[model samples]
Target: MYSRSNNGARSHRWTATLVMGQVLLWSCAAEAEKLPHNLQIHGFASQSWLMSSDNNVFGKSSSGSGSFDFRELGLNASMRPLPRLQFSAQMLSRWAGKGSEGNIRLDYGFIDYTVFSGETSQFGIRLGRMKNPLGFYNDTRDVPFTRPSILLPQSIYFDRTRKLALAADGVHLYGERRSEMGDISFQAGVARPLVRGDEAEAAVFGQLVQGHLAPEMSYIGRVNYELDGGRIRFAASATQLNMSYSPGEGSIHFVPVIFSAQYNAERWSLTSEYAFRNLQYKNFGAMPDMDISGESYYFQGVYRLTPEWEAIARYDVLYMDSNDRQGRKWAASGTGDGRHAHNRFAKDITVGLRWNITPEFMLRAEYHHVNGTGWLSTLDNPNPADMSQRWDLFSILGSFRF
Candidate 1:
């Protein structure tokens, strides 16, 4: 006795009610799936304003107030789905203020499989995304709250970036050999190369600006020996770079030699790392500016005066064949013939004090004096021309992290 329209309306209402019920059920199940330890999350809220008499060396302008800006929000979580298998993930979100939507980037996320082989040799394969192991420092390189200095030596690694050697999606093989002197471990992996068309173009001028780990072809291997007394690392790396400008016409060879030594105890710790790299451009123009071979190193001494306070003094240096066909990062910020042979060199001295205000919080203040022509700013400006302007720099910085 019901009309067709009435029948259709009733059917539609039933479908809608069913869909709502399904959504409510899913919401409840999702809430039930979370656990205290399985869903762990932690982050830091920080504020920093650059107080400089001048602008940045890169020619970029700074916000007028020195205005307080949020540096990072970190979230770390891990789960053990099985007795021998575990997964971990970390995210670092940066808020530079203004209209910046902020970047929710994957700091690290991978699955680790433990091998009962008894030597602390865990066979793990990472699928989602992983960090590159070009050198020792690239592993634990992070920002203010964790590092003793405001800036990581640019010669090695820089801050949170989408490119220029960072988290890449691939598989990693890491294992350590145990011995009486200590445990000697090795990490090696093969993946896409670190340089593409633009990356290649930038490297020609000696400014490895950004973008590493693309689908080109790269290999990294590292060996480390750690004992209760100390630790040492020996790393060897090779990368095959392919860029768009050159097409399949040319390639790059990178041979990096790395070394690290660390001694940690109850009150004090000393850590150091050195790297020597040889970069060759193949099938390119016959120019000195096109070929590059360079070396860089850093040494740090830490004194944990107490649980509440720590102090550190560090020095780092880089030596590049300044006279290559074109200039390098130490060269003035500009376009290059890709030619130069000036024996480019840059070195800086830094002294810092860290206050462990509490278990979850820390503060840092440091001073730096650098002598070099390239992007050398003792201050926190990204522009090279703003600070150095073809001269050396004396800069200071202060930042806090949680």
Candidate 2:
């Protein structure tokens, strides 16, 4: 169990860190004006309102008047004191229903040192907490301007498991080669995955456990190829994640592989990604050991109506267990009550429009027609039986950045 006093102290410390970081950034900026070094500061804030016809998301979206429980605020600073050395850090506070309570925390802080730099190629290493290069959007998922829509395709970027895939504390080695044909880059890291609170626990175990989940050493890597100055792109990423449960000697291991591709044209762009995940559980006293394989994919297209207006359409799908895509075997086994087959799979059709009012401000709205509850948050909708098999979600957001 977690103590309130301890939680409060942690929160205070995190807030203090953010404050101190901001102060340091200002100090660096002042000093940089006197020297040749460079310091850059950037930040963004966004608010969203969501309403659903028959489900809850980021609060009681289905309730009267809808919900305004979704918001994100972030600030970051980067300093280059030497030609081949750089330091960067970001502080973020995000609020999204019960899973995230808008706590201020260090998102990523790292020291990057270039081992070799030349006209056509470079090699470097980064130490400290850094974002995992899982997919194209995972590195910048929190930034609304970088996302294709209000919400990312849930099939690939499961918001419920965001914390788990966000960032890690360790070292990463990166290298890039450029030529007339295109550019090729790769990044690999060995770190400890961040597992906190009950969000990841519930997502993995289907419910919160009495024992705690402890992070273990893990590995992640990605490779990218781009042609025609990013008019076309391809990437492959993979991760081996491990965790342990205390007081009962339980363990978990999962491996996920993702493939991403995109094409950019003058007026339109197309994007797609596919992922395969294999999970294993062992040594739980009451739960039987098991292995599960899952699959997810999405196809998306965006068309620019004008210099400041855009439209998007996408179809996404998620299957929790590929072996039992319909979940007939698991539901028939009677593992628990309200275990419907539809809960194992989800299909979503989405459409949205984006309007850029100014260089630093924007607004967008989107609608989703979804079938199945596979990706719904268990926290917001505690009772599975109460969830509708088919539902609609409408959302609008406004964002500002500098």
Candidate 3:
């Protein structure tokens, strides 16, 4: 838990950083406008307000005035000095509940060199801090303009442990092939995963511990296929993330595999994804080694009322322990009181509206009817017994970009 004084200090720092970043981004954009087409710069800012009927999210959202503690700001630039080589980087500041403190940090920076290029195929390599191509959205989830709704399907995204999966320092090999049948692209990487924040530790152990989670060598890969120029698409991605706890806590390994599919039409689109997560914990103090498997999936549909307006609906589900979906076994084993059953699973129904007021500005509103608290952040809602089995969340956001 964080003290009120600490929260205040963090908020102040975030405000100062936001102002400085805005000024810098605008100045760079103004200068880039006069530069060659090889150089590009962009930035975005979003502010969100959320209110919940039960279980706090992104702050004390269940209370009066809800929470204005959610926001995101980002700036990025890319330069292609040569036809086959490019450099790109982004800086991001995000504030969300107690887990993220709105600190500005390097989101990604990388150098890309293409080894070969032809009319039908290309091969390349990238080295530096790069985003893990875990799913269709992980690479671009930070930008509000690219997200389908205010909040992504938590079942697969797991914002609680985002830092561990966000980006890594590594090298990636990529290739693409285009033919009359369709287009196929693949990317694979080996790197040291990022585990700086305490969020990943708290998520695995149920609370913040005395030790830290250290980064370890990991691997990630993805394969994507597009037919009829993206009218239909399919993707499969997986990653193995390794970490160790200091002071002799233990070793932890997380492996997750996802399958995704999407269909696009003139006015409507459909998307779905399924994920299986495997977690292993070994050599803990006196506790026996453990292995747990989790499952998640969601189906979503979007309809474009107009070029500037859209409507979205989705059903998302999550199970913390596939073997004990109802939590009867875990609850009976003395993990907690009977109320803990609801913590094992979650089912969410969501509806949202998006208004692209202009190419550079947008507004969004969404509502969620959720059952179970399986995905709630422990840092945000400390008292598990006080959590409600059913809850409601309403959110609104405004975003501007250049």
TM-score, candidate number 3:
0.96
Candidate 2 residues 61-141, lDDT tens each? 999689998888788879999989999999888878767767777899999999999999999999999999998999999
lDDT by residue (tens digit), candidate 1, 1-402: 011123334455445434433443454455457665554433444434433234332222234334343354455567887777778877665433221123455678888776555654555555556667755556655455665565566555433221446555566777766666677767677665434332233334333333332354566666776676453433454333333223334455556666767777777777777766676756544532255667777888889888898888888776655343223543454432232223245576777777777775677666555555333322233234334322222233343332
For candidate 1, give the lDDT: 0.52
**What residue pairs are clashing in model 3?**
none
Preferred candidate (TM-score higher): 1 or 3:
3
lDDT of each: 0.52, 0.88, 0.89
Candidate 2: worst-modelled 10 consecutive residues by lDDT = 1-10
What is candidate 3's lDDT per residue for 1-402, written digit by digit as tens? Answer: 232225557757678676756765675558656877898878888989999999999999999689998988888889999999999999888889888778788999999999999999999999999999987899999999999999999999988888887899999999999999999999999999988666776677766776778988999999999999999999999999999988896999999999999999999999999999999999887767989999999999999999999999999999989999987788888765445888889999999999999998999999999999988888888788799999999999999888
Tell me the TM-score of each prediction against the true structure. 0.70, 0.92, 0.96
List the RMSD of every prediction in angstroms. Answer: 12.0, 3.4, 1.9
Which runs of model 2 end up more than 4 angstroms from their true locations?
1-37
Candidate 2 or 3, higher TM-score? Answer: 3
Q: What's the residue-level lDDT of 172 in candidate 3?
A: 100
The order of the candidates by lDDT, greatest first, is: 3, 2, 1
